[model samples]
Target: MSNNVLKNLKPYEVFKYFEEITQIPRGSGNEKGISDYLVAFAKEHNLEVIQDEALNVIIKKPGTAGYEGAPTIVLQGHMDMVNEKNQGTEHDFDKDPLKLRVEGDMLYATGTTLGADNGIAMAYAMALLASKDIAHPPVEALMTTDEEAGMSGAMALNPEHINGRILINIDSEEEGKLLVSCAGGVRVSVTLPIKWEDIKEDKTPIVIRLRGLKGGHSGMEIHKGRGNSNKIMGRILYDLQDRVSYNLCSLNGGAKNNAIPREADAVLLVNKEDVEGLKAVASSWNEVLKNELKASDPDVNVQVEVLPDRYNKMFSKETTKKAVQLLYLIPSGIQTMSMEIAGLVQSSTNLGVVTTSKDMITYDSATRSSVKTLKEDLVNQFKLLAEVVGVECETRADYPDWQYDADSKIRRVFERVYKEMTGNDPEIVAIHAGVECGLFKEKFGEMDMISFGPNLYDVHTPDEHISISSTERMWNYLIAVLKEIK
Candidate 1:
């Protein structure tokens, strides 16, 4: 903890609270200690605290002496974070504290995610809890869990637990922006069965890996034109198999459902006589890919290594042909860009995870769209694609889109405050990525919501960093809005 509370309390002080939080591991669906810490903080501060069965915490601060009759406002944000690290990061997200570092005006963690997405919101909450000088209306600070993996905690919020109808979700990544809408999303899994056969063609088994792609959040960075490892590996196989007779053994890629796959590996048995032809085919495809996505994915790489293996069996010829054809044809990148918002993505799909087994293989992907009807149409399109490929398709955990509220009162207040603080109007926009605001609005009817935050870059990845200067600007805006809100 810092020595001073309010003296010279800039935005980085809020970030200091975030640095301390990084010491505690609070991954999705596992937020016991963090929850306890929050309750204890509320108790120590003499705030009214309520803990729900869903493990959601709401700490209420009664309105300032003069603003008692104003509407109660909810300051909402999630508590849990996505635990991710780089290829060689030694820090354990479960036990070790996040190593925070400062470079210029950016705050980042060493070799791991900094968890500033919601940690910033948590710090803002702590600042509010510690503040006795600021005059504000009745405020409810809601810290939820399991937001990174899913909106389970937000979905479980009891609408009647608090009397706050206006909510400000401090979870967005961009500063000087008001996020009034967000896309709805769901996960789809396609499973295909495979039959094994003996490798009778005197073939050599080789382990091939396609790695070093700059992976990012599937929803946020889909239009950045980065290469998907799953698609890259499939393309390599598709081209190589045409030049050399090969039997595929196994294919696996990616770890999470929301991340664009960064690496993929495949084992294949190829005849020794056709090795030269296979090499040439791979070279041609690599050149083609490098030329095609040079601007977006400059570091994309594909490598192969021969392995000594007595292959009992490989995928049956018929099954292998079907699998390869299906995987190669499935769309794994941005589908459409929004005509309404310049540089905004409307409909997109991500081929996130793939795994192969003896009997069957499973590939998981996600789709997102802010337009409800368009989302349904895209899901139907995916179902049709799966049917054509002879695979069983299923979708789960569907969440509704947070429709844009152009006339939202909360947005008006935020816009006025932002203008007053910076002498310029903030950008009021909608995000293509899904936010918990949609889930909360779905569970609780007619809740006015707006989301804003400091600038954060490359979240859910090892290169994540928070802009300290932007955090200061956002903090000033937040304070100004609190002072003006009725």
Candidate 2:
């Protein structure tokens, strides 16, 4: 705390805790360091805390004065962040603390993702628990883990551990907007078998790369019209089926199953006589992609690079056809829009990751839909594709969507108090992205929850940043809401 980047910022305790925790790496599936740090912080403050097997931390504080009898208000947020960085970023999510930079009104991490999506929730909960003057009810801080990758932490939380009926999730992006409902989601992966054979004719190995697209959170930015590298690569190869003689050796791209893939590459063994023809297609395809994505992703690039080393094995013709067919046939991007809520995406899928192995190639996708039937329909579509293409498809982390509650007490309290404080009504809406709230709802059936936070932009991307002024505003609003609850 001696030379903290955000030590002097307003709401000193919140920023102070935020900086301290940022010093600990808390990427998805690697949460022990930060989880232990949280337990230590709770002990330092003398709060009752519980650390579960999944590294989910729950710290309990008794209500202040007359509010001791008030129902427990759960302050919930995940502990892990999506570990995403720029291609040339010189930072490690495993050990390095985020390099903080404050610009005008926004706070960003240089070349890496700032963990403010849910880290701010921890900071706010810490401030609430540590405050001596602020009034509040019995507070339970439910800090789970691995939310960006999946809802495993939240799913593993024991229901008997919580006595809170009112849950205020501080994981939303916009400050003044209250998220009442969110789309449910599941992670689906398709593994296709590939047959390898020795190349008979001498062929030139060339790598076709697609990059520079503005990739983002699949659910949040799916309607943005950004290019999906995996899908685009499939289209390229499919197009070349007639013009060139080639066999795919390997194709891979993307890191996370929930983030839109920004870059992808495919290695092809082309006949020596057809090398120029493949390069010609690559050049023409590059222009086509640029023109199509000019408004949404102007920097989109597609290039072919000649490999110096030679590849001995190439995918069999039958295997290659199945692979390209599976990639091109899979459904992606916006599928449906809400009729009740204008401009809201109701159903969508993201082709997030592509990888090749010794005998199989896998494609991972995240499917989100607010409607249960629609979500099921989307998964069935993939299953049908797998049946036709002769591949294996599996789904996991299936969570339901949170439905709207008309008599939400916590929401009313927030709306009324926020209006009184800012002289304007906060925007009330539902998001297409998945949050832990849905899983919590499944765990506690009677849970009444609302999700909101400060202004965060470009989540799950290296350009992610949070608004400074919005944080201060949110802090004040949360404090007021806690006091008013009783």
Error of 2 at 346 (Å): 2.4
C-alpha positional error of residue 444 in candidate 1 after TM-score superposition, expressed in Å:
1.6
**What lDDT would each prediction earn against the true structure?**
0.82, 0.90
- Model 2 worst lDDT run, 10 consecutive residues: 1-10
lDDT of 1 at 374: 77
Candidate 2 collision pairs: none
Q: Against the true structure, whose TM-score is highest?
A: 1
lDDT of 2 by residue, 262-333 (tens): 999999998888888899998688789989999999999898988998888999988888888988988989
Residue 351 lDDT (model 1): 86
lDDT of 2 at 69: 90
lDDT of 1 by residue, 273-322 (tens): 86666666765666777787789877776777778777888998777777
Model 2, position 317: C-alpha lDDT score: 89
